[model samples]
Target chain A: MRSNTRKYRLMILLCIAVTFFVFILSISIGRYSIPFWTVLQTLTLQESVDTTIRSVIFEIRLPRIIAAMLVGAALSVSGAAFQGLFKNPLVSSYHLGVSSGAGFGAALAILLAAGTFAIQLYAFTFGALAVAASFGLSRLVKGSSTLTLVLAGMVVSSFFSALISILEYVSNPLETLPLIVFWLMGSFNAIRIPDLINITPIILVGIAGVMLIRWRINILSMGEDEAQALGIDLKRIIGILVFCCTLSTAASVCIAGVIGWVGLVIPHIGRMFVGPDFKKLIPMSAIIGANYLLLMDDIARTLTTGEIPIGILTSLVGTPFFAVLLWRNKVGWS
Target chain B: MTFETRGLSFGYAKDRTIFENIGFSVGKGEIFCILGPNGTGKTSLLRCLSGISMPLTGSVTIDGKDLHSLSRAEVAKRLGFMPQLHSSIFPYTALEVAVMGRSPHLGIAASPSERDYDLAWKNLELLGISSLAEKPYTRISGGERQMVLLSMLLTQQPDIMLLDEPTSHLDFGNQVRLLELLRRFSKKGFSVVFTTHFPSHAFQLSCTVALMNKGTFESVGPAETQLTEENLRRIYGVDLCVEYVSKANSRTCVPIIKNDDGRGVGAR
Candidate 1:
């Protein structure tokens, strides 16, 4: 019964509080457990804190947590925007073939390159290009044809995935193959401030663009013809949205590998709060998604002695959560 | 505002022609009915006049301006449209669906104004289903959905309205009720173009009737002049039966003439 602005504000407050709670828990729960007071001191760099606790918290946990939260927010927001654009609940931010495209890019990078930065760059560029190609091809075939777009996405995904496997078969098994496989599963580890610094602007700009056009996104969900009839140049709106979503999603994929279900699930979860209104759904998903991923990462690192791939842990957690949601609600594509 | 099409002909694709070299026009304050059977390019023609689709060989002008040249928002500002068989395709509420009609009035990145909500609510109230505004559009009855559609179009507040088979899905009572509403809309100098198969309904309500045969207009004129027994028999391929229904409080209509041998001519 509350107005949209009130509901939106309340959701934001809730997200902020939950995110703070998760941030505290994320720093405190690792193998080297610290007291709440010491964790606070370590965080605020209080004079009483030990050097080891402070170094461990700031150097190791903080960057990983930040990366997880950023990746989570990026994927989910991208997913939410994508689901709204296609008007299909099943589509994620990666539905435009970003994952396949990015994987192909990464494979080529590792195959040809010598180091970490080069590999990341390879995945980033190729992944983005792959998505761009898929979109360009879809545009060629899809003229007011939603079905054609879906079909074109499928064709592009299948083609790139094949290229990825082919690249996998030819690469050196000990070094490049494991890296590609691990990258495919996704990870969050050993990331310094530079990785964080690199993707921050892309994520921020993409999120801002989506938020600015959120109301127009609501009209876009009414199907393209209705949007056009209402004076929305659908091509223009869709063009910008695709760039925003694809950039965030590809950037997240660059850092996190292929963390599967955040994009697939975040928008659906956000809908439970606001009844599919994007003006509320997008922001809520971002906050919730950030917290959700950080929490999952906390569990992943804490439960195991050595680091488990974040992808493995997320799949282990996310699949069951998704199943419960689907069982409770009749999850139709529309 | 009046809308007139000067030789509007359209096609679905290069080889697939729906309309071939057609022309029609409507003046202000007139209930102009275009009567045609299914797939006689009725919907396509409606799209063409609404400026959603372009004509293949001719042009349609609205208030002396060419329809094809105007921006869609500009066209929408002056025109309201009701597409036949619009399944919501998502779980939008009747209110949400109706509010989308106001999109033409909003600038990019702008929320709808209070006047937009007021117009939608007023239209819903006029349609007598303001209480059902929060209901899911797909969950409503066929007739009720039809009324909701009309309410949405009315909310557009366009000086001209175009509908394809406006009364097709409603029951007899609501069908007549909506026809009456359309009559009133045209009477208020809001030019209205509607396509229907019911000749008698057109005869009772419309100021003009346009009968489409094959892909072109066979006849266009006042209903009494065009919708004759011979025309009905030829168009519908029925032996044209008309019945009179008695109404309340001492009212009677002329009895219909039946076939002398009681053998009605059956359509092959």
Candidate 2:
């Protein structure tokens, strides 16, 4: 047991180191590339690098890097918490209709030619609204079983998705339609330092709240009756957890425009390495998720002159890897 | 703890009451058994005592304090509930499941500490399932899972235990083993209340027995006095013979199964 603890600690430390390296690498390797030393010199307040290179590092690359990391960590942590709360490994952060709702919100904002702030606000509101609808509909059913919630989520998701399609269909193909398509595809290109500043507290507080109750997630996963018998106030804890998880997820979607696969796949990777104890898994997922998305964004931006949408990149990589993970983790989830 | 119920009634819906106006009490170091057939309110009554469900009509009190008035943690610290056989979705290790028994004692932000881990290990050892600590709970057999749950309850260190059909899924050997463990717990000054379909289990354990039918307990008293053949017949809706075993110094119940022609199966 002691050795197992040592190994997991070492693994977590190693993951943090790798995430830091990837963060630096992502900032250095973008288009209109700055040299690694120049990036570092600018970051460290050295005057050797040119003003243009310094501006690229500070103004553009820094915000994108930070956005990528935050979105990754936020989505993955939310996914981990949701999976534990629902007691199903198959659950994703998107299973509750947040992505589809946010997608529609972004499309509507684009059609109305709203600024970034309004777009984000609209996305966050509608994302939360979608989940509320799902939960409310589930309660109206007889038992409010897990299956009912999942089905309600599907209903709300498709409803919002259809709204997005209608918005895209009516808008002129030359202007708003293309903009909506690209935003729905997802990117971190539009992120500025102010965007990062605005999202940081929500993500941090959400993550902290989840980590504090990480142990209880284990009990909650044991089914409602058993958890209640163990003295957990089921209604209060679950309500708080859902709020925290959705807060982060909505904040991420508002900024990044509905990135997929990170929330669904990163937590599974964390579980594969750390086991299902949420105390360990939540942190592991956070660090690994940050690194995973940063790496994916690096490839998305650097692979070609025209930037690839991160959602496309994530699904391209995530689906196959998750299939492999499911195959290997036969006993764990199945 | 002195656990008692007064005129308690409960049901999922307003119009349907599973049990009604039932009352009983068990002092420290006593064993209380509720025996009834399927669809009776034995499980519901146990749930009420554990504070998992509120009694609609009356009240349950532990040590003269109303059970509903206590916080969930306080109730959990005093009363340990072992639910019927359930399968967990995640692959939590046996030790982890055992350690969860300490949750009631933890603050909202606190995880189990080293001392808590030691207590869990000690309880697992006491239950003779220490070797299964590292095994996944989902991977264990039904009987071993029950023992693991028992170990978890032991780690809880509650003054009273409420078990709902604990031995329903166990084999005969395991059933006997669990009964022996309950007797040991009684000797250690823990009050036990369990629901069971077996009249023989009520007979084997030296405790107060309650025979329940419909919505109320038909009789409640020492097993020797309460578990009459006539009561068993009415409760079970089958004619049964309650006989004394001289060598074992115990009583057993055997159902008189009727053959196709209405003759007793044993007689044929």
Candidate 3:
């Protein structure tokens, strides 16, 4: 037992180290092509760096990198929590329709020629509203069983998706249509320091809240009756988890558009590393997720002169990886 | 703990009361067995007693304190409930599942400590299933799962244990072992309340037995007196004989089966 704890601790430390390395590498290899040593020197506040290099590192590359990491960590952790809470491995962070609602909100803002701030605000608000609608719908239909909530989420997701389709169809195809389409495809190219500042606290708080209550998630995965018998305040714990997951997932979508697959795939990878004990799985998912998204973002910007939207990249990368995981039969829900 | 229920009734809807105005009490170190036919609300009754479901009327109390007023943790600390069937999605180790019994004792944010793990291990060891500690709970057999759940409840260290049809899925030997363990725990001064379909189990324990039918207990008394041939016939709608087995020095229930020749086999 002691050795097992040690092994998990060592594995987590290794993941954190890899995340750190990925973070620095992502900052160094952007469009401006700063060297590794100069990136290191600028990060350390050295006197030898040029002003343009420092500003490029701080103002552009650093913010985008941080946003990618935060979004990745938030989505992945939320996904893991949702999977455990719902007791279904297929569930992702967006299972509650946050992404669809946020997509519609972003599309609406872009169609109106709103600034990034209004788009983000609209996205976050609607994302929360969508989940609230799902919850309310589930409550009205029956008691809050996981199956009912999942169905309600699907209903809301399709509803918002239809609304998005309507908005896309009515907008100017040449101007507003393309802008809305690009934003929905997702990217970190538009992320700035202010955007990072806006979302960092919410994401961090969400992550921290999940980490604190992660052990309870293991109890929840045991199923509702048993968990309640074990003395968990089921309503309170589930409420807290949904709120935290919604906060982080909505904040992630607000910045990164509808980046998919990180939440679904990363937690499975984390489980392969550590078993399904959420105490270990949650932190492991956060670190691996942060690294995975950062690497994806790096590929997005550098793969071509014309940047690929991260949503496209994540799907392209994540689908095959997920398939490989499935083919190997190592998703580990059994 | 002296656990009691007063006029407890439960139903899914206004017109459908599964059980109504039933009451009973269990003292320390006593074994109480609830025997009833299928669809007799045995599981629902256990749920109400465990506070998983609110009773439609009346109240359950532990040592004169109403159970509804206590927090879930406080209720859990005083009472442990083992469910009939557990379906696990993730492949958590048996030890991990066992350690979850410590949740009510821990703070909201706390995971089980090493001490808690030790207690869980001790319970598993006590149950003679320590070898299953590392096995994935989902991969283990049904009997082992029940034993693991029992170990988990033992780790909970509650004064009273409520189990819903605990022996229903066990093999014959596993059933005997489980009953023996319950008897041992009762000897050790823990009150045990379990629902089962087996009247023989009641005779084996020689404990308090309640035969429930329709929406109320048909009879609640010592196993020897309440588990008579006529009462068993009435509750089960089957012809059964209750007789002493000289070889085992215990009474057993045997259902009468008719041969193809219309001869009554072991009827009289």
Best-fitting candidate, measured by TM-score?
Answer: 3
How close is every model to the real structure, measured as TM-score?
0.91, 0.94, 0.97
Question: Which prediction has more favorable DockQ, 2 or 3?
Answer: 3
**Which residues of candidate 1, in runs, are more than 4 Å off?**
A1-5, A37-48, A142-144, A332-334, B113-115, B241-268
What are the per-residue Cα lDDT tens digits for candidate 3 across A1-334? 6216889989988888888788888888967898888888999999989999999989999999999999999999999999999999889999999999999999999888999899999999999999999888888874578778899999999999999999999999999999889889999998999999999999999999999999999999998888888989988898899999999999999988999899999999999999889989999999999998999999999989989999999999999999999999878777
The alpha-carbon deviation from the true structure for residue B113 of candidate 2, after best TM-score superposition, in angstroms, is 1.0
Q: Compared with the true structure, what per-residue lDDT tens digits does model 2 show for residues B1-268?
A: 6888899999888789998889998999999999888888887888888888778888889999997798888888999999887778888888888998998999989988878888999988887788998888988898889888888888888999999899988889879988998999999999999988888898899689988889888888999888888888877788888899988789998888888998787854
How would you encode candidate 1's per-residue C-alpha lDDT over A83-156 as one tens digit per residue?
A: 77877878877787889888888888878864767767777887788777777787886254555566677888
Residue runs of model 3 more than 4 Å from their true location after superposition: B261-268
On DockQ, the leading prediction is 3
Tell me how each candidate scores on DockQ against the true complex.
Answer: 0.42, 0.57, 0.70
Pairs of residues at least 3 apart in sequence or in different chains that clash in candidate 1:
A102-A127
TM-score of chain A of 2: 0.95
Candidate 1, DockQ score (0 to 1)? 0.42
For candidate 3 chain A, the 10 contiguous residues with the lowest summed lDDT are A1-10
Measure candidate 2: CA RMSD.
2.5
Cα shift from native, residue A35, model 2 (Å): 4.7
